[model samples]
Target: MATTNIWQQFKALIPEGVRVVATIAANNGNGTSQAELRDGSVITVKGETVNVGEKAFILDGEIKGTASSMAQYEVEV
Candidate 1:
């Protein structure tokens, strides 16, 4: 069975421009392990699980995927 992280799945279900506080625990091999906000800053997530302390405001275009050719779609925070 494929196990995907809760943070990853939760982030994926949300639409753009929504304000969210999330903590990245594990990356699903897509390069990013944390939530990206509307801003232009890539925050590095650490640990196997995240809690209230690790929560952060979602930055714009911070979620980096495996698509190396999708650079044009990135938004500057």
Candidate 2:
């Protein structure tokens, strides 16, 4: 599937009030690397590594559970 649709599907599944957690142990390159979660804090498999010219992981954060404090951490490569 394409990136946008996958993201849209993810958004659809998540309830409005639910919290989502995003963490990273290590990352390189520049574009977003998506991890395959397996009910663990760490990604089950190594994600695809994009390049420096692309965008950073826009989803890294600890969910705030509130509307205002939506924490977003951008790690510069």
Candidate 3:
């Protein structure tokens, strides 16, 4: 659980899994798929039915939902 405390009250921020955006590179066809992150790293995302080449929000190896397909720009600071 991701928690944050404000005024001595605890609140959960990211309920499950780390928030990450990845593109589905391959669908294993058994409810599991391989996703590629923005850094060109590949990871296996399980328990979500996803299509190839679709960007998705992954958490705890599960799909929270789809993400925007717009072009992404990173600023190096």
On TM-score, the candidate that comes out on top is: 3
lDDT by residue (1-77, candidate 2, tens digit) is 55677788899887664234433334433433433222544441233342322222323332222122255566889
What value does the lDDT take at residue 62 in candidate 2? Answer: 27
Alpha carbon lDDT of each predicted model: 0.44, 0.38, 0.81
The local distance difference test score of model 1 is: 0.44
TM-score for each predicted model, relative to the true structure: 0.25, 0.21, 0.75
Scored against the true structure, residue 73 in model 2 reaches a CA lDDT of 69
What tens-digit string does per-residue lDDT give for candidate 3 at 1-77?
A: 53355633433332544889899999887888899998999998885666788899898888778888999888999
Estimate, for each residue in 1-77, the C-alpha lDDT of model 1 and write its tens digit.
54478888888788867344454444545444644433644455433233323444443524322222122365689
In candidate 1, list every pair of residues with a backbone clash.
Answer: 37-58, 37-59, 37-60, 38-59, 38-60, 39-60, 39-77, 40-77
Q: Go through the candidates in order and give the clash count of each.
A: 8, 0, 1
RMSD of each: 13.9, 13.7, 4.4
Residue 44 shift from truth in candidate 1, angstroms: 13
